[model samples]
Target: METRKSYFFVGVGGSGMMPLAMILAGRGDQVAGSDRALDSGALPAKFADLTAKSVALFPQDGSGISSADQIVVASAAVEATVPDIVAAEAVGAARLSRAELLSQLFNAGVLPIGVAGTSGKSTVTGMIGWILHACGRDPTVMNGAVMKNFVAPQAPFASALVGQGEAFVSEVDESDGSIALYHPKIAVLNNVSLDHKSLEELRALFGTFAGRAVTTVVNVGDAESAALAMSLPRDRLVTFAIDASADLRAENLLPEPFAIGFDLVKGGERHKVRLSVPGRHNVSNALAALGAVRAAGVPLAEAITAIAGFVGLKRRFELVGEAGGVAVIDDFGHNPDKIAATLETLHAFPGRLLVLFQPHGYGPLKVMRRELVAMFAERLAAGDVLVLPDPVYQGGTVNREVTSADIVAEIAATGAQAAHIADRAGAAAHLVALARPGDRIVVMGARDDTLSLLAGDMLGQLS
Candidate 1:
């Protein structure tokens, strides 16, 4: 019998941390955690959800660690100087990185599916989880974002679903090289691109990840992922793409304002796939999910049928509401690829974009500064407006070399209407003021969940 363990997470409110905490608490483990966000009183609903699950929440001031038997889990971003960490050290509690603990839990599953990529991992994980559940697999799914399909009145934040079945589905992160920690029965590679790591580093990490899996599901539509797929053993690989020949192919693509339709072709059999989520990127995500569940032994047709009901994650191009002929959207598009995809999806329609993008953090801004500027400069249409605030800073010290102002200036050099507001609310106010009829106001960022509230506020004001 597995003994119940007591665990405390230092950054419990984080996108990655929250789901793991939920999974642990769901399994009858003693779970407690603290977050900088909780201290600042941000995103109360999330904390409330955790509290409702019997997971204790605390201030980041080290009060949560009362016993030495408690295991402290912290993300890589948490410094040793954090009050929680300092407290845990003083209490002689064992410590583990979030990835270390998640990998341990995930690897222990009878069947583990690790979804990896620069983008769409969360969406694809949600799709596969939904499909597996619909097919009666009853998978335990861990994701970074809330799966709308799983959201219930009692469970508003449905990022983690605990089940008794053998299958464990989770999106694995490569940002901290933690993708290497998970050994999955089914590894789904949505795409390999420059996000947190270099292309070279990404290729190596993704290659080894694919190599370790019993069956690798890859997207041939992405150049980097396609190259990775080509290198893997053919017998262990299942590939998918958009408008190209692969094990699973999506053709006859059609984009709607809030949904998409595609023809999924697998093994010379054709089936129409309609996703409640919009964008070509999601079609690729659907293909990757189909490939993954298919590799997991689910019938492709049944998987396709289940996937059509996927409503997508909460912040991935989520339409907040339309008011006074202006549509407001909330999205988690921090990286260049994700931002570009959102821009492309919105541009497919007729509205001019009024974008307010908050960089997730200073570190990512420094890493992808050039690519971000280039993406915004090229993707923002002539009439579109872009606003940015300073990157999210919870507490830790970071290099301030790359600021939002720098990005805005570089993008403005290309004649795009860009501004740096330095405050999120001010930036959002600017976007709301600039938004007009026949325009779409988009709030894009990550790490911080308050952006959704900002979008809703904008919608209310527009009304």
Candidate 2:
């Protein structure tokens, strides 16, 4: 746990591992690691940024660990048979999961703000970080996605920011059940739904997370979140909502294609707030950010002003390009709730959608097969087109009983134009042929880093 010790990450290039690596390296730790992606030379720009910041890059061939004094960090997905894990075991180095290491750093002499939920964890974390940074708090932020406000020429991958302040803001994941590791000063629970686990299991994990925080920022609009808030002491709970009454609420809501304007009402004082990110879900996210910063002793008006300038995180309804009157958007929405929220935002505007959705993995597709079909069937319009490519393969043995074709078949039954293309290239070609001047082509998925690149390439073809 010493800042000056040597640390090696097993999957260093992953979204979760990269930011932690950068933060450790920035704090004068000797950070080095490797990934399967590194061996294949994928995401060159991200690896280059890490190397520039003094993080040693290595292949996944077990050469990164040479001594027993170095601590080896591995993500939850890293298997015991992996070379990095084996090497660390052979060298007698201390091994820690990514969440364990992050919890250690977060709990060390800093005011920790943990954002936990099934969705919108990264966005809320970024919003809180931006508000604190803009108000001169100089907070260090560790996020899973690149915050556009912190992106600079030298730091294209702005996932983590090392600042000289007392606050440490991070998004905690519940999928792997690591959210219980940290006792945060302020905990923000966005919502509870089915994503990585069953509903009952998620409730228990999130309830414990909310119970440990000094101040719990609960979204009252979500029923499960509201239920958790009711169990906490009155003084320890700070609530925000868009529908029901709460400590912070958004009234007179207005939703546009890429922006939303609303009145934030707190303590009978109304402040007009506008966000650059689209969707009603983002309005809920904004309220959670407001309550979090308020609990951290930031004035409500100052936090509201900073929220307006927040430019949102990458791949969260990111507009890649507009060519020939056709716009292509890149989004990281894989689960049913996330996908439904994105579709609702797009439908609010007046454009035919050409959706190309790739399932993140086979396991999730099988778990949420019925819900996925029902979502696409009910949400998609008559003239809209839904195209699906096979789930991104990451070298795993999975049951292939439920596939993309099943979802497509269900959607087509509901009178929507849907197709399942086997590869991304074929899906892109089909989208190019079907795209018209007034249509918006949305490329959506999760877990895969190349989806953003594919979105840009789709734009090029339209032009």
Go through the candidates in order and give each one's C-alpha lDDT.
Answer: 0.92, 0.91
Can you give the lDDT of residue 433 in candidate 2?
Answer: 89
Per-residue CA lDDT of candidate 1, range 1-463, in tens? 1548999999888889999999999999999999888888888899999999999998889999989999999988899888889999899999999999999999999999999999999999999999999999999999999999999999999999999898899999999999999999999999988888899999999999889999999998899899888888899999999988899899999999999999888786889889999999999999889888888889988998899899999999998999989999999999999999999999999989999999988889989999999998889998999999999887767889989999999999999999999988888888888888999999999988888899999999899
TM-score of each: 0.98, 0.98
What is the C-alpha local distance difference test score of candidate 1? 0.92
Compose the digit string of candidate 2's lDDT tens values, residues 1-463: 4679999999898889999999999999999999888899888988999999999988898998999999999976788888888999899999989999999999884789999998899999999999999999999999999999999998999999999899999999998899989889999999998887888999999999999999999998999998888899999999999967999988888988899999998887989999989889999999999999999989999998999999999999999989999999999989998999999999998999999999988888987888888899888887999999999777646678888988888889888899999999899889988989989999999888889989999999998
